[model samples]
Target: MSAKPSGSETEIVDGGSVRRDHTDRFDLRALYETSQLLSSSLELEFVLNNLLLTAMSKLLSTKGVALLFDPLGSAYRVAASKGIAALPTGTDIVLDGIDTNDPMLEDDVPERLLEHGVKLVFPVAFGHREIGLIGLGPKFTKQPFEERELEFMASLVNMSSAAVHNSLMVEELKLANRDLDGKVQQLNTLFDLSQEFNATVDRKRLVKLLTFALMGQMMVTKHVFMIRSVTGEGDNGSNMHIVTAKGVRKEDLDADTIASMCAQQDMVLFVEDGDSEACDHLREKGFRLVLPIRQKGDTGAVLCLGPKMTGQTYQPDEIEFLYALGNLAFVSLTNSYLVEEQIEKERLEEEMRLAREIQERLQPRELPVMQTIDAASLALPSRHVAGDYFDAVRLDDDRMLYAIADVTGKGVPASLLMS
Candidate 1:
């Protein structure tokens, strides 16, 4: 069975008796309640506030109190307080060594507290670590804290330390969960956008769809689609050209400037107000980005997206999303252009095959056999039709003449002239 708490008393000098009062019983109950409440609370701020209030109400019975901690700084910072009229969020009290060993002792503590009439202090500890210090002002009942009150306060600190540790773990878990959820949502949106954008073959329509889709999904304020000629024959010095734009002036974009900015085969991003020397021209033109559209080793063009519609600075996650979007867009655009080129190539090949067949029919199948002269002639066509021609004519009295000549070029014109 647990030992019953005795209402012990002691005699002091000056004809005064130091008796354990009813307040001590109340203090024990308050300590138990504080432990129970803290055990259930997983919030760090609630645990701190509850600990401060409980100490003030039970341990010293102070009308006002403040809790300070070593922020590992030059002074003790107030972490929490109660019953104070005005307490700054960050208030420090300097320490002077009255007693070198016990800094929390009343005589060794700050003079500012002594001037303010503070009487008692409790040094909070967890294992070997001194977590903080709690200063209690003069008691509301005008009595000093006895030994029993100090014991109860120490027990409260021990129980509350476990709660503080658990609350910190819970807070960290909450932050990690939020970050994971954000990444998952971004990936899901990117996947859906990629599938939708790649389903079409029309280059112009694909770019427009991708631009509008990204603007709607990514919450961008503006979008610009640029295309570069692989053969590089245009008014712009570089092959980069803007195909479509929204929320920016057409004249503001310069292909040469964008190419120069993204010279080292990397994507460019600008989300904040200021601009570097590499991007100052864009800032002067009130543009935010000149993201490169690249595929393989080739720098095709750029897709410039402006600041987010929310008007807040772009976070790291947003920049990552833009990088991913640019990659996917580059692949899709390259695929569409490649498909178009293949179709054109196949069409030209078919035309060349038909022309070759027509030219073959026009050529002489068999040369006239020459009986007088003991000679034979034959012709063979190369993979592509060429301009070699040979013919034999019968002359008077069985005298035969044969001639062979080569034309200048190959293909239909050469084949026609040879015919």
Candidate 2:
């Protein structure tokens, strides 16, 4: 069961009986009801809507608007409104002198609000700072606001400010949570790719694996991957080469573009919307960001990412993941190069061993056992396959001919040339 609310009260003062006035008692009930309704929910829009409606009803006004100050943006935005020209919620109004936290009449209101038929402005405040404004138009009766009415509106704003602040806090927290969820997803993808990178040794296949990972997880549609040469060729300075391309072509990206975009190898570059020639050129190519990979204090590789299919800019952690992926791919490719080099070195060493053996055989064995003047000779190869040879032949009746030679080079070529 519910009992009807009463506005009657009694007080014994000065040894006499006195009764509380109905208007004062009624105002108390209204304030209590307004506070209860405002506190019922933390939804910002709901709270602001109810607040605007209550202010309109109390003032008997035809138009009203709820404006919340955005400290970060340094402006006020329309949170809710009634009977006014349609200004969408969150539309910014950059009015100055609004932070005075004082009630404003028609003459005191800004010209902008005056155009919207706002006749009164009440500041919504908590502690020392005013967070918002409640603007009311003229009453339906066409009469000016009374002194008590102004007082009541101030009281209503004071009561509702706490609820609005709480709602704003909750909304900000939800946004933060959303950003964190994205970060976790990206890191998990990186973890899986790291394992795959370890197993991949072929450069072409490694690049394919990385490209697929970006397309699947990051919603990347257009991308290019370029890696600088590690061999240190002085004549060419060893510029980076395009290893993979999706929507972009190898010829479209010149050497200067890659070098300029990757100037800051330690950090990612976010393409800003601008009129500069470089920026316009990148935008024309559909590239949105550039991620550089560092090796020995130099730009070793770069991953040029185009816009996502969803048209969302890359988040901070997403950029971090791409940079890490580029580095991982580079490490795997470097290892592949080293493995191939080792195999080649071993093959050449085996060829050298065979050449040395042949060279020894071709060398004069025992020098034909010369019996002239007790002649003797020995030819032992050093650690290398040198082009060394020695021989002596008797040229008819005590005339002797001898030949000895050592090639300038070593290894298989020298041994073959000497033979």
Candidate 3:
């Protein structure tokens, strides 16, 4: 028998002889380069494809390669492959544990490998987690794999596993960022719409604007505003009047019934799909939401909405938006009422001023310098412009005409007619 080679030498055992030669450093360099390439990229698809291509070109010395990932419960998705005749994209393969000794290999194997002259199957895993498997066809030189080649293939599989793990983490981070961005955009839109609503004072126009703003911002199908009159007789009685409504039939709503129910229940908000008994009747009536419009501790009105245009149920965010919109409507209504009242007060004051002018002219100026038994007369008007008149005129031959008259009211009409 031939003597065994030293530690630093390569030994070949053929027949009954042993030959020792220097080890080839090229294979070691190839392995290091492959590891560097695999570690550099964290993108899942890029890393996976590079790993397969590098292994086939440098480590395994194969003409073709294939990478498969068994998402376990999901499909057996193909990541990358080379050297096969038009390798299927997103192909599923059944793997079996008996088919290969690779630790990352699955229990069900693809049957095509048997017919296609596959030389090796490598399982790639991160710790105990089986990320995927690799398959390689025979080398172009048609040479059998030596022990050294098998060892290098094993190292490549380890590098591939780490790359796959990093890629998956990156993908998960990207998805999370996208979700967060969507939420932030929604919040920004809500804030802007709220600001616009707060600046208006016309009740009818405000209600219409609010409904349209909410629908556009939140992408809802329809919104309705049902404003109940504040002044009405009886506490428990049906006094709810539909002052304004949109996106629904005014005739279809029973305003008195809704008002009475709201008054009895003492509920300010009624979400039709939420867990509340107050919303039961509203839900049956095809309304998806009912938001109360409150002003200074009194429930003055209700704003309702149907389902969203997306046909999805309302989320907590959507409910909050509706509440804000309802509050804005109440503020606008109150402001409009105050403006109307002030205008009416100013109008009445103007009329009183005009009446005073007419009354002052109606009285005789300087009392005609009369000398009928030394008579004199004076008239004084009240703050409300009363129509009290006094007159004295000297007639021919020392005869005098004197008269005093009072009209009922104290305005332009009474003053003009008094003349």
Q: Using lDDT as the measure, which candidate wins? A: 2
Per-residue lDDT, model 1, residue 149, is 73
- By lDDT, the better pick of 1 and 3 is 1
For all candidates in order, the CA lDDT equals 0.66, 0.77, 0.64
Model 2 C-alpha lDDT per residue in residues 65-150, reported as the tens digit of each score: 99988888888899898888666676899888654568999899987889889999988877876678889999998989888888
Model 2 TM-score on a 0 to 1 scale? 0.78
Each candidate's clash count: 0, 0, 9
Worst 10 residues of 1 by lDDT: 1-10
Model 1 pairs in collision: none
lDDT of 2 at 346: 96
Candidate 3: give the clashing pairs. 64-83, 94-108, 94-109, 95-107, 95-108, 95-109, 96-107, 96-108, 96-109
* Reference-based lDDT, residue 16, model 3: 67
lDDT of 3 by residue, 1-419 (tens): 45565776777888967777545433676667777887898887788777777767654455444555556544345567676655565666665444334522212335656454556777777876666667777767677666666677787787567778888778879978876786686567667756665666666666667767767666666665655554564222445655454556666656443753355333334454356554665665566766666656666766767777788877665676667666666666656766877888899988777767766776777665545466566666655676678887778657778888989987556666777
Whichever of 2 and 3 has more TM-score, that candidate is: 2
RMSD of 1: 7.7
